[model samples]
Every structure is written in structure tokens, then in C-alpha cells.
Target chain A: MSKNIIIASTSTLHGGDYLEYLLPELSVHFEHCKTILFIPFARPGGVSHDEYTVKVSSALAKINIEVKGIHEYENFSKAIKNAEGIFTGGGNTFLLVNQLYENNIMTILAEAIKDGIPYLGTSAGSNICGLTMQTTNDMPIIYPPSFETLGLIPFNLNPHYLDSDTQSKHMGETRETRINEFHSFNNIPVVGLREGSWLVVKGDTITLKGHLTARLFRQNQTPAEIESETDLSFLK
Target chain B: MSKNIIIASTSTLHGGDYLEYLLPELSVHFEHCKTILFIPFARPGGVSHDEYTVKVSSALAKINIEVKGIHEYENFSKAIKNAEGIFTGGGNTFLLVNQLYENNIMTILAEAIKDGIPYLGTSAGSNICGLTMQTTNDMPIIYPPSFETLGLIPFNLNPHYLDSDTQSKHMGETRETRINEFHSFNNIPVVGLREGSWLVVKGDTITLKGHLTARLFRQNQTPAEIESETDLSFLK
Candidate 1:
């Protein structure tokens, strides 16, 4: 249970610098690492691998850490196994999971994470840490081999989770309604991680962090708000 | 190419009754039918098959058109072939498409639509009429056998499409950004059917119906707002 991970709801907050809010925390998370492998498969706005990697590099530059895109490697599995640390940026979950499966590195990355390599994930990146990517907010731009994921956590993570706007006139399904529908067919617990909030996984303990509270959804129960500093290890 | 269909952005408007706005049109579209087969695979808010079917039945009762759930039939393919008309209710795109492929009836339904059987699709249902469900906004509650849909139209559809609220502080990916990501990998055109707007397909001519404008998105081209009654045959 030596899972050292940071599952964030978003990579960049609105009006904030890229990864600026989490730099201090990440600085400590990756203290022992020199370079971290970045998986840019989620392709934020369909950015190219190199371009997305550059974004990550720029964000991590302030922390004095180097970043490399996995797509640049000739052997992806070797890259995962040999990486000092790993950082998966967010975009479309389907595309990210598709590339992970297509390159046959899903299991390798999962093993690496389980082996206690520091990991940082935001949005779609954090989604794969759950049992499956079934709770993602991204469009299904690509079909993954399966909905299965790393299963680093027992429950599913719904990143970029937002509460229904009471004044909105939109008829589209709200985030809560969508998750309830997921519960109709699934028995897994779901953590609705709000933007700026994240889960800090250290060994067998997972503590909710940042400035906001998270919504926890379970089958046949009213969703409850979990405050910061809450230990969610019980969900495991 | 006598694809007689009504692809709606939503089954119900923000404050309108279920299918109330579309009843007159549906009355004409399903004029020759006594009973229309209803596929309730997209269970909105985790509604039961029977419960969702009842909602559709109630909505169509005014038109004197009886509605039957496809799940009630012993053979789904036979049910599709025997249907005088078909209506796929919107819920979850992934769930609906999953059931379609799982029951091995995607081809059957596609054939029925191609043969010009009167058809009605709202939201997730309308999403399946496109080249793929890559542009869907529904959470991926389940994984379908393929993202390939019925291909009833030349382009994809984004139902319940909305514009970004300028005053809102939400940082989630906007509909435009999601579609742009889809275009980065796919060259297909996408129609963002806003609430209250629908497409009336007759033969090779697809006319925008209802009172609102539908936004059309093509790769490398600026997205344009198409007024009601505009013939979108050029997209084909």
C-alpha cells in the first residue's frame, strides 16, 4: 500500500498560472526525483505530445524538475519502469486510456505507481488512478481497449466535478445526475473532486487536500460533502 | 436515402413538458404508425427500463401512438424489424450504444433507419445517428463494443449543445473545446443542436427544424450558426 500519489481535479485553475498552486506541494512530492516521465496522451485541446510535454516542463521548471514525454521514448514500458517519477497531464480520458492500452503500458505504469514512484495526475490523468475511467467528464474522442484502469484506488474519481448551478436553464444532465446514472449500473463509490482540491496518497492513507470540500457519492445514499484533511482511506 | 427522422437536442425543454414541443411534428412523422418501439437503454438519472418507457409512452399518448420498450421483446432485432416506427430515448450515450452492440442489434436498427422507417431520436439517441459517439457529453457509464455508431448521417452530433456562459467561473472544458479536440483526430463535421432545435431528415435533404439555430463545426473551418429551415445538404 505504498502508493504515493497526487490525484488533482484539474491541472490549471481558472485565472491561475499553470500548476502554480500545486508547485509547493509537488516540490515536496518529487523531492527525490530529478526527471519525471510525462504522459500527454490526454492531449489537452489535442496538443501534440511534444507540445504538451513542453507545457509540463514549463510548469515544473519553477520546481527545478525536468520533464519528458513518454511518446518520445522508443520503448514505453522501459520508460515507465525506469522513470524516477511520473506525471500524467489531463485532457480526454478516452484518448489517454486508448494510447495507454494501445502501447501496452497500462499495466507497466500501474506497477510502477504501486512500487511507490511519486505520481502526479490532474483531470483525465487522475481519472485513470481509479478502478475505471467511467466517471470522467471528457468526451469519448477515442475508444480505449477497456474501461479498466490502474485501480490504485478502490473507488472511481470524477475529476473536475462541479455542483449543479441552480440558476442554469440548460437541460443537459448535471454532474450529479450523471454520477447517479453511473451508480445505477455500478456499485463503486465515487469521489467528486472539485477544482483546486486533491487527494494525497501516502502508503495506505489518502487525505483530502487543498481549499475545497469534495463530494462523495455512493449507491443508494445521499451524497455527502467531505472536508479537507479528511482521511478517505476507509474507501479503500 | 429516404432517411425520415427527427433528431432533437433534448426530449424535454428546460421548463417545457416532455415531448410537448415536438408533438405536432411527431404526429406527422409517425402518422402511419400505431405503435413505436422505444429503446430506453439510456436510462436518464438511472431510471428503470419500464419507468423510462412509461415516460415516453405518456408523451406520445397525445398523438395516439402507442410506445413499447424494446427491452420487452424477446428478440431485439426482430423487434426493430417489426417496428412501424422507432424512438430511442436519451439518457446515457455509452449505455445506449453498449446495449445496442451487446444485443447485436446495432446493424438491425441501422438497417431499419436506412429503410426509411419513421425514427425519433433525442439527445443520446440522436448522438448515435452520427458517424460516432465521440462528441457525446454523457459520462461514459459503460463501454460500448465500438465508438462507431449507426452512421445515419455524414457528420457527428453534440446534443443539448450549449454556449459558454461568460459570467460563469467554471473551468471545465467548454463544448467548443471538446469538439475541437474531436476534430484534431477526426475530420468529420459536427452539428451542435441546441435545446429546442432539431433536424428533419427527408431523403438526402436535412433541414434544421424548431426555432433555434444549430451550430455546425467542421475541421479547419470556423463554426457557423445555421438558422432554422437552413438546408444542410452541403455537409453531406
Candidate 2:
């Protein structure tokens, strides 16, 4: 079986409903699976696990998919092992990675994904699909055990990546400057997935999908803007 | 001896020369000291140690103070111990804390500050004067061995803190939201120091300085705006 994944920059774009923009793709992506094991550890807006899980359930119900939060299961590792399809929602990346390690389910999830169970990740979820969580834009609210993350993709992912507004006078480091600083200490490539963009991964092939282009950062090279439908397998 | 420290929100304000706005305060802060040891480990924008040191040197020269980069010394710990004053410049907080741990100089520097060596810190540097680097706004470009920092101040500091710009359409989390999330996981109070604002620590008294009002976030309490000259020693 080939791995099938949708790594999205965000769960919802500005002025869009929760997970509403990706319902069509998700419907087809999880067509063969009836139920999705939802990992709500990210918990955006400081929502409880149960509440976040219900949000996911409501969104997926439109496509006739049943959803269950991993927290609802007796064993999280077992839940991952038994899941036919999985979806990890967006929130704080540090919190998500910390819980994954604390619950000791990282290995199980990686193994299940390697075995080709369909997977969907958005924002913080998409960030964990990379080599490490070092490139995340989220605040360091908590100290995770490690910055290491699932290496489903050869490189790291920078979600909700926005270009600098030239007209603005914000003195904080721009997204490009931050990524370049990451490259100074890390050699891994980073794909800056702008809002409304995602990557579709099937087997050994990965294609960029969405209306916008992504910015790619390589060590010592100028960042390139990749258009929609571009084959990104070469990055692997 | 009483501790004399300046925890500034930024090294440079918008449209200002490096450390230009704070030069008058810094000159008085280091009145009796002829030379100050500089820690440039935070290396903003991927600048080299010597290069960053040079930038600091040029900025301090306006106040007629000599600056020495910590990297130039043979014994980093001993150099910090013998320094009359210490200054940690702003940059990536993760890199700053990582180097402080790797060099095993966190304790030495913390002790020096406690014993009244006259310390000055801006941005990432100021964030480390707190209990941990959890409130920093920098991206996680690297993972430090620990989030623990010098507990010179009893609470955490969020430097370069900006309030929500309602006119903008950006969908990212606000600084207050991030700090609230931090409080959800940890009970420490956070001081959101806006650019141009700083805290002047003399002995056990910490007074909010500069023109702007600082935002204070305590666990389970509404955030309050503190005016200039407001004594924050109670938070200790």
C-alpha cells in the first residue's frame, strides 16, 4: 500500500469556515475509510480535547465520516494501530509534539503512516510531518522533550507562511529571515506553505496543490516560488 | 551590593540607530564601569559572533564604553566572572539559551547578575533574565537543551510585545493569546514589554521605564496596563 497524506498550511483560511475549504479533497482522500481517528492534542484557542474532537466530527460528518478522538480510546497507541484513517488538527505545535511524546504514541503513528493508513494534517499537524519542529512559527509556550518530529517528508514544513508586507513597518524578523537563520544551524530544506496551500503525497510522489505558490528554502540558495501541481518529489 | 540591570524590549526601535534610544539610560546604568562583556550568541539574522560584537561595540561607543565579545576570551566562565558589566543583545532566544547551556556559563552569568555586575539585556537577552525562555517571540530555529534561564527576575518577560492590530487581516495568534496559552500550562506571570519600554532593576525593586505602558498577564487574572515608573517589585 502507498502512503496517502494531505499536509495543509492551515485548517481554514481567513474568512472561511473550519475545514470547509478542504472538504472535497478530504472526502475523496478518505473515501475507502468510514471512520477517522482524530488527534485533538493541538487544541487551538485553548479548547478542550472533547470540544476540538467534536468540531472535527461535525466537519467530517458532511462527508459521511465518523470521527473519534484518540483521548476517547483506552490506549492511544492501540487507537493509532486500529485507525483506518487519521486527521490531526491545527493548534500550538509545541503542545502537540509534547503530548505526542508524553503519550508515547509518536512511534505508533509513524509506523501506521509508513504502513499506508491515510493521513490528514493541518497547521501544527502538518508541521509534525516534517523532520523537526524547529521551523515552527508558534510561540514556545511549553518545553517539549525534543524538537525531533516524524520524518514523513524529507524536509521540514513552515505552515501559515506569509511573505513580508513591504509597506508595513514591523521590525520583527521576516519569514524569509527566520528560515535563513534556521538554515544557518540546520541543513534540511524547508517548504514555506502559504495559507490556502497544501501538499498531496501519494506513494513516492508529492505534488503541490492549491491556488497559490509555495516558497522553498535551501541552504545557501535563494528561495524559489513553486507553482501549483509542481512535482516536489525531487526535494526528497 | 544591589543588582543594577536594564531589561529592554529591543536593541533598536523603529527608524532608530542601534541602541540609540537607550544610550542615555545605558550610560547611567554603566556609569562606573569602563568595559562591559558582550554575549553575541543570539546572532540575529545569522550574523557571526565577531560581526554581532562589532555592531554592539559601535552602538556602545556612543556612550564612551568599551565592549568585549565573550567569544574572544580563552575562558568564557572566568571572563564573565571578572567583567564589570554584562550585556546580552537581542536575536534568536533559542540560540542564545543553547549557547549559554553549551558553554556552561548560565550559572556564572546568573550569579554575576545577582551579585550586582550591572547587566543590560534587549529582546532575547531580556527574555532570559526571567524564569525561562517560554515567553519569547522568536521562531524555534533550534532546540535548546533546556528552557531554563537565569531567574534574576521572578517572572517571565515577553519583549518586543505588540498589541493586536485590529486594522490588519492577519489570522495568526496574538501575543496575548500565546502568553495565555503559556499560563494554561505554567503558572508563571508574564510581563509584555512593548518596544521602547524596559524594566529597571535596582536591588529588589523593578520599575517600569520608557514611555509605553507594559501589559501584565498573571494566572487566572485579567491583564493590566502598567504605567511608567510603576513599581513591579510585587510580582517578585
Candidate 3:
């Protein structure tokens, strides 16, 4: 079966409500499904799973879609298998990957998504769709058993990608610099997804979405700017 | 033997030459030492170990102290043991920790520093002096065998800590937010050492250095703004 996915850079854009920016796109993307199975393991601000679920639930309700937390189910793998649609909210990528591995649902969810179930991932959630979680900007608060992820896509992602502020005196590595460092150790390509940007993956076609142009970094090559609506299926 | 260490937030400040800001203090930090051993595993910007060593070598030349890379020695542990002073340059924390474990010199180097070998760590280097490298802001680039480090200090260090920019529309987690997420899973205290700030450890006493105030985050406690020269021994 062909895959259907919306991998977004962020759940909430600046000054916007949670999942607000993507609501229009998501409504169409998840039109066929009545509900979305919410994976709240990536708990932003360390919110409890139920609390994070409620936030996503209320947001998706605007489009008349009910949301259920995967944690609410008796068996996580069974939950994913039964899910008609899946939406994983953003938080710490390490925490999300660790929970998925610990619950033995990482592979199950990956298979479910590949089976053509509509899926939406934001920030940390979007990161797991990559070849590895090595390019994540989240803190390694808790170490997962492995850096592996779903591998739904051929490349990795650097979410909420910010350009360097020339005016600022801060010496922290810029998003580009960090991705360059990642290239130093791994050969996987990385997409620097800026806020309000996302990737639309429909089976064999993967296209950049939203207003911003994404930065693409490949090993031994200069990073390129990918405009909206650009097909990125060539990354593999 | 008492510990004599300088753990800094960054190697260089904006518009400053490498090690320019810290040369005065570093001169005193390594006053008794004739030659210092350099650990260039972090390799900022993916520079080679020898290339990184050359940068450090020239920088320390201003202090009239000779420098040597640890990679130059066949017996890595022995080189560390006989070193009068040690300096680990800033770069990718994961790469640094991975290299240390791979070489089996992590414990040896830790012991050497604790035995009164004057040591200096900047950025990724300073991160290893903490209880764990969990608070670092670097990309994971590579998977280290363990997040464990020198544990020379009671708490973890978040080097190059950045304050949230109220004016910017970027949705990335601020340093404080990331550290807060860390607190949810780990109890280790984390010092958010801003660029230009550092910690001076003389035996059991660890004091904040530089002109800027550092932020301290403890589990379940409100983040505090620490003043310069303030002793942080209470974190233990």
C-alpha cells in the first residue's frame, strides 16, 4: 500500500494556536477518517500523556475529528493497528522514540503508516519519520536504546530550523551548523524545516509544503534551498 | 589531591579570536604547566584532530605554554596520566564522549583531572565535567556508548546557554525549556552557563565566573539567576 503523511516542522507557529497553521491542510489530509490516534509520548513542556492528548484532541475537534490517546488503549501495537488515522504531536524526540521502543510499538506504528493510514507528525514526531533521530534539536534528556527511527523517509529532519542571527552575540551553533556537524558523522541527507513548513508524502511522491523554503543538506554537497511544492522524491 | 578546573561555556566569543577572551585567566590556570595535553575529539566543524590541535596550539602559544594532541600518543591513558595540564576544546559533545569511550580513556582522564592536573574545558569540553552530558545543546551526530562523563562536578552543565528571544517568531525550544524537559526525567541539577560565563572549580568549591549571570535549574525548583563569583557548591 502507498503511504500518506504530513510531516510538519511545528505543531504551533508563533502567535498561533496549537496545530492552528496546519488545520486547513490537516482537515483535507485526514478528511476520510473520523478520528486520529494521538501518540502523545513527545510531551512538550513535560506535560502528561493525557494532558498532551487533550490539547491535540481539542485542536483536531475544530475539523470534527475525534482524537484518542494511544496510552488509553490496552495494547499500543493493537492501537496502531486499529487506528484509521494517526497524529503524533511534538516534544522531545528522544522521549518519543524511547517510549515507542519500550512499548515495542515503533515497528508496529511504522508498518501501520506504510499500510496507507493517514498520518501527521509535527516537530519531534516529524523527526522519527527520518532515517535516524541524529539530527533532532531536542535535548537528550533520556537516552533511547537506539538512535533509530521509523525510516518512513530516506532523509533526516532538523525541525524549527532557524537561520543564524548576525546581530546576536550568542555563539551557539546555528541550525545549519548543527546539520553540517551531523553530516560530518553520518551520510544521511537532512531537511531543515522552518516553522510553518511541512513535507507532504503521498506514496512515491514527496513534496515540500507551506510558505517557507526548506534547506536541504546532503553529505559532501552544499546545502540547497527547496521551494514550496518542490518534489523531494529524489533524496533517496 | 585537589581538583583545579576551568569549565567554560564557549571557546570564543562573537567577533573574538579563538581563546582570546579566556587567555588571561587560562594563563593563570596553567601557570605551573610547561606543556598541556589537548583532546581534540570534539572537532568543531568536523575539522580533523590534528587540525583542531593546531588551532589550540597557536592559541596557547600566546600564554607561552606548549600544546600536544592526545591522538599523537600511542598510549592514550599514559599520555593523560603524565600530563601536567589538560584542555578539551569545544565541539560536538556526542562525538567527544564517543571518542573518549572508544579510546577507553574516559576514566583515566577523569582520574587525572581529579588528581590535581589543571584542566580546562570549553563548551562540549565543559559538558563532560558535569555529572552527565545530558544537558548539552549539541546535536547527537553520533551515539556514545554512555551519557556518563567525568562527573567531576555534582551537577550537569548546559554550555552556551541561550535566553529566549522575545522578539523572534521562531518556535524552537529555548534553553530553559529544553532543560525543563530534562528535569522531568532526570534529577541532576543543570547549570545554564551562558556564553562568556564559566565555572571555576578549586577542589570541592565550584564558583561561577565571568561578567554575566548564569541560570541554575534544579528538578522541581524554580530556575534561579546566579550572580558572578557565586559559589555553586550547594548544588550537590
Candidate 4:
């Protein structure tokens, strides 16, 4: 079956709008596609259902894309196999991983990807694309025996990268140190995606989308900046 | 190297105070033990260094147990090998797993636990005592490339069991359902520890501490109540 997929970080339904980051490509991808299957159940933690899914579906409706939420589907395998385009909205990665692992949907998703589903991942949803879910700053507030991921993108993705606010009262590892920690163990490039930004992956090619720049972290080299046209050899 | 251990559900610093729930036998276990080590860094998310570690020492000092906070020891090997008795504080399970996996400390800790060091885990720290980090309410907020743990105590540990408060205001998965999901994949019994509670593991014996009750979620059966004197066969 033909498949194109888009997985978002946390949908703006709660905090901010990721629609602008998601919709343009999602709409363009769905433009020629016959049907779009919207996965609202990807909001795994259950907190995300009322917060984001409703907002995303309404926004996509305005853009003329017929988006269908996946939670209403009776058969999960059919929902996954029948979709011409699959868009996974993000909420909580643990919850997402838990549901996928429980329902045995991760294997199906990986198969669809290998079969060239034209997948797109953003934020938490984007996180599952990497070799492992090892770089996100989300709290392991929930646990799923394994940190298994889709392993499609073959890179560690850091979404919503923010500078340490010296004025803030939050006390935890800073973003820079956390990324450094990722580098301490992983040789793969860690992509820091700012708000409204994304990594667009086509056949054997990956390019940046939106107006935000990305910070690349690797071992033994100073972190470098990647402009829009930068070669994403890591993803390729 | 005499070893002392404190396996608590919540530390005195995390505003949960496990000492009040301390079994009288535990106090005797550490009576002759000088050089008490406080492991506050195990909890990577919620509790801060200042908030969790310093208080552990100060509280232990009140009872004449010479305490030392191990937060400054960045080296995992030295931290585990030379430690007198290691106490793991609670925060988030994902954060602890990532650090243990990234630094390769699980094997070191497993060895330490085997040497009869009094190992204590509370909430997030306690969750790390399982075979896998399967039963937790923390988000997969931080992903370590893998999900291996200390394997100190057999059976999964679920800290802080709570009922769903109508889900209209709460944002995360309910504790019961999350544990239920965990049982669907794992056949292991899950020990639900409330605040001010703990499980003291000595050799093959598992003793329940704290005034509150605990729920045990087993495979294919309804969760059963674990009374004060009930011996947990999973600890065997």
C-alpha cells in the first residue's frame, strides 16, 4: 500500500501552534494524496486528547484537508495499512511508546516506513524516528519497559531547543549539557529543532523546512550551524 | 567495607519523608554504619540537587548517622565501588535510566548491590530496582538509548499509586491504568508504593514499610492488596 506519514512533536493544541510547522507540508503532501489518516491516539499520555487533537483537526479542516482521527478506528491494523497518508500528532512520548508497544503498532509503523510511507516526524512524534528515543528532555514520568523507537531517521532529535534562562527558577540539567550528554554516548548527529522548524526527508535526501535554524552536535568538534541548504548527510 | 542500605519509596528531602515509615529493623541495619552516602542524583527530573541531597545528610545527621551526599562524584565506577551504603533518591525513572545506560552504571550498581551494600530506592529510585523501567508515571521525557536498569531487586516497583480524579483536570495517565498496561506486556508483579512507604530487600526477603497499603498487579488477574505482613513471593 502507498503511504506518506507525518508525526508531530506536541501539537500546539495545548501550548502553541505547531500547525504552521506541520500544515504547509502536510497539506502539500496530501494535495495529491487521496486520503489522510490523522492519529489523535498518538497523544499517548491521555492528557493530550482534550488539549491538542481537537485543535489540530479543526485547523486542518480549515485548510481543506480531510483529517480523520485514529482513536475512532475499530481495527488498528486496518487504520495503519489503509492510510494513503499517516499523520501522528505528538503529546507524550512515554504514553505514545506505551500505546504503540501495547498495541504492537510500532512494528507495523516500521514496516510502513521501510515500504516508503513518506513519513514526517515532528517534536515527540519526530523523536520516535531516531535510532533510539535517547535525547528528549521529557520526564520519564511514564515508563514503557523499553526505550524502543521507529529507527527510521537514524538520528537523535532534540525538539524545542531552548537556551538556559538564568532568570528562570527551574532546576535541572540545561539543554546544552543534556545534548553534550547525548554526544558522550552517541556518535549520531543530534538535531536541535526550534519552534516551527522541521527536517523534511524525501527519498535518500533530507532538507530543512520553515524559517528556524538547527544546531548540530557531534563528538570532538565544536557544534556547527546548519542553514537551510546545509547537507544533512547524517539523515541521508 | 561495611555496607548499609536504605530502600525507600520517597526520600526525606522530596517532601515525602520515608524515615517516618522506616522499619525499626532498618534503623538497626544502619546503627553501626558510619559514612552514610546519599544518592540524590539518581532522580534526574523533578527534585533539584540542593532540594534533595543536602537535606538527606542533614536529616541523617539528626539520628547520628554520619552522612555524605554523593552528588559530586561524577565518576560512576568510583561512586559504586567505594560507596559504604548507597541511597538512591526519587524523581523520574527515565532520567535515572538514561544516566545509568549512558554511563554504563547499571552493571556497576548490580555488582555493588551483590556485595551487600545497603541499597535504597524511593519512587524514581525504587523504579530503577526493577528488571526494566516498565511501571512509572514519568514521561519518556528523557530517552537513554536503552532501557536496562540496576536489577537490584526483582519485580517492578510502582511508586505513588493514585486514583483518577475524573480526568477533567489531570493531564497524564492514571496510575492504575498505566500499571494495568504494564501488566499486559509483563508478567512480573508490580509493587505500588505510596508516599512515606518503602520495600526493604535483604537477600531474598522483601518486607513492606510505611503506614499506607500497597497494590500488587499480577498477570491476567485483578490487582490484589498487599497487607502489612504479607510476604511478597516475587522477591524470591
Q: Put down candidate 4 lDDT per residue, B1-236, tens digits, no spaces.
A: 33234456555423334454453544576665677666665444344666767667765665667666666777767867887677776665666777777767778887887788777666677778877676664544455666657666667777766545572322223567666655544577778776566676666667776676888777777877777655564542
Better of 3 and 4 by lDDT: 3
Docking class of 3: high
Tens digit of per-residue lDDT, candidate 3, span A144-213: 9999999999999989998887787888888788888888879999999999899999998899999899
lDDT winner between candidates 2 and 4: 2
Which candidate model has the greater lDDT, 2 or 3? 3
Better of 2 and 4 by DockQ: 2
Per-residue accuracy of model 1 over B1-236 as CA lDDT, tens digit each: 37899999998987899999999999999999999999999999988999999999998999899999999999889999999999999999999999999999998999999999989999999999998999999998887889999988889999999997787667779999999999998899999999999998898888999889999999988999999999887884
Q: Tell me the lDDT of candidate 2.
A: 0.92
Candidate 2 lDDT for residue A207: 93
Local distance difference test, each candidate: 0.93, 0.92, 0.93, 0.63
Error of 1 at A45 (Å): 0.3
The order of the candidates by DockQ, greatest first, is 3, 1, 2, 4
lDDT of 4 at B140: 49
- Model 2 is docked with a DockQ of 0.71
lDDT, model 3, position B161: 88
DockQ of the candidate models in sequence: 0.84, 0.71, 0.87, 0.10
- Chain A TM-score compared with the true chain A, each model in order: 0.98, 0.98, 0.98, 0.84
**Candidate 3, after superposition: displacement of residue A55 in Å?**
0.6
Give the TM-score of candidate 1 (chain A): 0.98
lDDT tens readout by residue for model 2, B30-101: 998899999999999899999999999999999999999999999999999999999999889999999999
Q: What lDDT does model 1 reach?
A: 0.93
lDDT for each residue of candidate 2 in A5-98, tens digit (9 for 90 to 100): 9999988877877899999999999999999999999877688999999999988999999999999998999899989899999889999999
Task: Report the lDDT tens digits of candidate 3 across residue range B1-236.
Answer: 89999999999999999999999999999999999999999989899999999999999999999999999999999999999899999999999999999999999999999999999999999999998999888999999999999999999999988888888788888889999999999999999999999999999999999999999899999999999999999886
lDDT of 1 by residue, A160-205 (tens): 8999989888999999999999999898999999999999999888
